[model samples]
Target chain A: MNALLEAQGLHLRFGAVRALDDVALSIWPGEVVAIVGESGSGKSSLLRVLAGMQRADAGQVLYRDAAGATHSILDASDAALRRLMRSDWGFVHQNARDALRMEVSAGGNVGERLMAAGNRHYGNIREVAAHWLERVEMDPARIDETPKNFSGGMQQRLQIARTLVTSPRLVFMDEPTGGLDVSVQAKLLDLIRGLVADLGLAVLLVTHDIAAARLLAHRIMVMRHGQVVEEGLTDRVLDDPRHPYTQLLVSSVLAA
Target chain B: MIVLHTEALAKSFTLHLQGGVSIPVLRDVELTLRAGECVALAGPSGAGKSTLMRCLYGNYGADSGRILLRHEGAMIDIAAADARVMRAVRRDTLGYVSQFLRVIPRVPTLDIVAEPMRARGVAPDEARARAAALLTRLNMPPALHGLPPATFSGGEQQRVNLARGFAAGHPVLLLDEPTASLDAANAEVVIALIAEAKAAGCAIIGIFHDTAVRQRVADRLFQILPVYEPA
Candidate 1:
């Protein structure tokens, strides 16, 4: 099967820094590709390029949503890109504060996505947002409250609910479990893994934790200094060390 | 080791916009959070997550019940604490990150982050240096530090908020849903930094919706209930 979202020979730079250089990868339908890297390794730059926030200095990101429509993310106009983001693609940020409009309540945050997709009925929006909130382990009462009142974990969940409420086809998540504690992280990862599997949505997850990649990704790609050092099935890469960086990452969690 | 406590913590809003009408945003709620542990409050739209946080932070007073803060050598009855006490606690012991850009309009980014230090009477030169270090940790560009934060991107603005919240050396940090706008990669960077801060012994309280974010950082979790109908 052809890859749903594919990148070829991608390169991005900011004066002295080569954020992404000659990077290539692909994701088939319902695939989870974990991009792992250390700090300053261009993990985010790659996601940004794929999301069409920053125009790539070189290369292309080819993506196809569930409806079998394909487009180049980097080539679309602002309106076209916005429409796609609103309807087909959902981006989950690491921080709940940035992903939501703080000025509005939690219901508004989730409802805005629905409105963007043309759901104007307040009653319907509330019902859908409530259901998603519960799935993400949130109470419906806090929907009127801004994320300010809740804990860090809840904010991230709200962000997920806001996007997933629309049932997006592809989600780009950057370190979904970065700041959360172990128990909460466990429950959340379980939720995400289950949700993705059930919905069959393709996901691109970015994280630095090898364990996270092992647990959530179908395949893992290790990035160092703005380029992919190694890429393969998660279990295979974990079982046999191919790249030096991969070696360092996997050995840390070894049973022996 | 409890840093903040809410007993029967209840709040309500009376938005009399249309001919003596009232809106009860929150209702009977109770919460207690200890130091060194992160907690997540999960709820749907109108569930009162933000309302609870604001009431705790003293953004708005709860209509009834009591909010208590217990710190080393200082215990506060948050409900009755005067503005002076609140200011002192907020300055020396509290760090807050709201969902939106909370920085002063047109203020240089450096000053915004370093505002806490300046508030605590730190020297101007030293505060600037502290701001620089925090900004660097958050991956903010050095050159952008001198400009007013209003011109910065949403990510940078939030970074500035985080910097300001932490720069004060406050023991308890409060964040209102900090990562709803960033792409995945930048989101990771911010969340990782929050973890580092917590490990450094800052009592961090954050509001978030991303399950992964909550699961990764929270030590305890609560579901803040809301009153669907206002009386």
Candidate 2:
């Protein structure tokens, strides 16, 4: 697999707290890398830095498109990163509404990504939105209703549709099934696994669920206290955890 | 014990596009909630869960139905209550956290979280103190208390919304997907807070499709039929 994205020696800080220290991550084309950690373990900070929301103190994030050209995201300006997000990258938060506009119709939210990509015709937007909504298991008729009226899980699904509709090459999902029930989480994880495989898009998944990591990730990187402690093939790491922190995390899930 | 009850509650909107076309949004539905209870609404999109909730909160007018709130002696006709009366009722009685609309530009995070107390006539100093306490409970720092919520991330903003709804000290607190985007750890804290608020005599009506949240807070689960086929 080709290295589609890479992060090298990334260092981040929030005030005096060391959020990320000499962190490194790399994503191959059509591979899902799960970054797993405890609550204060700096998983979110790393994702934010890579996504260009927060600037890292040092190091670099490099992306190599299919053309063999490498782009350094760490040095890119905010405007340049946003332009990249518009066409080539997708980011999904744990909450769907944050990634969406609530006041507008649900169709508008999905179509807006297309709009950002320059599709302005309402009919075309509605058509693509409905098609994607069906793919995400939402009602096509309610496509006209505002997201405020949609259930929590439904809204999240709408968000996934919005992101996937753009057909971006790389996507970042932060605990996509975080607040959902086990049954729903299972279903959504399955849906995501299938979609990521079918789309053949590279993914960087940050999550707390070990089961989710086992299911979706090609490789797992265990983090603790703002650092990566263990990294390897997910099944091997989960089956035979070398790091003590990875053992603790795997054991807690087992003991539960 | 049934503090809130709706009979055949229905609401619909006319969706007028380029051509003056009309469409029905919500069908006639029924719902009930008792004192100190939390219920979860689960269904696919366009199932009218949000429309039903808006009517219950009196934000949207119900087309045809009876909404009665159980008072000390009798059931008050909430549907018939005047605007001023409804405003007063909402002030002291209800708390709400919608899915979005959480960001209050230029207002400090702590101030926005404490706006509920101010609305209910809590003193300025007391409200600020209370807001600080609320943020502390959510594990947010004191420094963030003075900064605008617009500066926070999605997870942080959701926590602000959660703290505001849970700590408002109202009889009825309504939350729409309060933890929808929160991670497992944050979601667990939010669920515990919801149960804590419920134990404190607050009637909670929250909508969630997450099974974990439903299992955590929903004493009685309302299994509405999904409008779409299961994925």
lDDT of 1 by residue, A1-256 (tens): 5677888989999999999999998877767889998989999899888888889898988888666778898898999888888988889988878788888888888999999899989999999988888888899888889887878888888899998988787789988877898777767787787578567788999998787777678777889999899776565456544566766676667451
Show model 1 residue runs off by greater than 4 Å.
Answer: A254-256, B1-231
Candidate 2: stretches off by over 4 Å: B1-231
Best by lDDT: 2
Q: Write the per-residue lDDT of candidate 1 for residues B1-231, one digit (tens) a residue.
A: 788877776665443233434567666677777777787887786788877777676666667888888755666787676443565667787777788774443458887787679868899899999999988877888999989887778878887887787788777878788777666776787678777777777777777888788888888788866676633
How many clashes (backbone N, Cα, C below 3 Å) per candidate?
60, 6
TM-score of 1: 0.52
RMSD value for candidate 2? 24.7
Q: What is the lDDT of residue B93 in candidate 2?
A: 76
What is candidate 2's CAPRI-style docking category based on DockQ?
incorrect
Sort candidate 1 into its docking category: incorrect
Candidate 2, residues A153-196, lDDT tens digits: the string is 88888889999988988899999999987777877887887688
